[model samples]
Target: MIPDHNNRDAAATPPDALRVVPVEPSLHRALLRLRVRPAQRDRVGSMADLLADVTQCPGSEPMAIMRGDAPIGYYRIDASARSVAGRDFAQPARGLRSLFVDADWQGRGLGARAVALLLEDLAVRHPATRLLVLTVDCDNRAATRIYQRAGFVDGGARYHGGRCGPQQLLLRALP
Candidate 1:
């Protein structure tokens, strides 16, 4: 069950007790400082680029992946699935973009937890959202594994022109 909004703690707490909150001006500076490993950049855009996308692109919102009071990572939700995947997903489908966990937080289940929280938040606030879609560099085995474990399945679409080379589309349908 989704936690009750009346209970702020429960509403803020997600899988593994990680707190996922909407990105606020107060957290932007800290979130911009969160970075993945040097090589992971090709797979995930930097927070600054993500912020710009949220601005230039409509129908997207920046989210902060927080651990306690500290901003630990970032993710963006794009209500217009077309923005990311260039396909006609259901009208309410959201593009899960720019998911990045700081290098120090990698391998600690942080990314998965952030995804869980985002899913719950969407279910609560955007009930019409039918699915979540993303594209990961096909060679990012670690991220692919994490998304697979979090219930995303290959959507059978591949792109050859991504900045990071071949990419595989993954989709997770919301219940």
Candidate 2:
């Protein structure tokens, strides 16, 4: 269990054995091969695209979701939601962007597990964060369902800027 950043008395549930690691030179080739399903290629951008954005986008941190020795998933956390989105986006919120599980790892429930672990770690790392946010293309029912089951609430905001157009914004409170 990881200790909460604000309250050391509390601990967030740790991933069974998965760890989210920072990007490293040695992992570049492996990380580059991680991809979502073919149909999802349009809805969800590639890891390469995320890497490009990470370079120009300040306050965005790219991370690799590692299980034992291999990277099973990839995601980014935006610390400056105010600057990326707007002030009304659940204040002091961290935006979860570009979350993707490898095509081979799908249907194993790893995505939700990864999200749970990531949120717990974020709570410890960002004590001031009151909420976590993410945007999903409305048609991506699978992704939406997993997030909702994980406690993300639909914020009723649609974004026209998504790759597939019209994205739904979801928000979750952090302890």
Put down candidate 1 lDDT per residue, 69-122, tens digits, no spaces. Answer: 677888888878887789887456888888888899898878877777778877
- How accurate locally, in lDDT, is each candidate? 0.80, 0.78
Model 1: pairs clashing at backbone N, Cα or C within 3 Å: none
| Tens digits of per-residue lDDT for model 2, 1-175 | 3222333443232434566766666777888889889898887678888788888888887788886557888988987665334555535788888888899989999999888878877877887998888888888899999999999998877788877878888889888
Best of the candidates, TM-score: 1
TM-score of 2: 0.85
lDDT of 1 at 155: 92
Give the least accurate 10-residue stretch of model 2, judged by summed lDDT: 2-11
CA shift of 73, model 1, Å = 0.6
Identify the runs in model 1 with alpha carbons over 4 angstroms from their true place: 1-7, 10-16
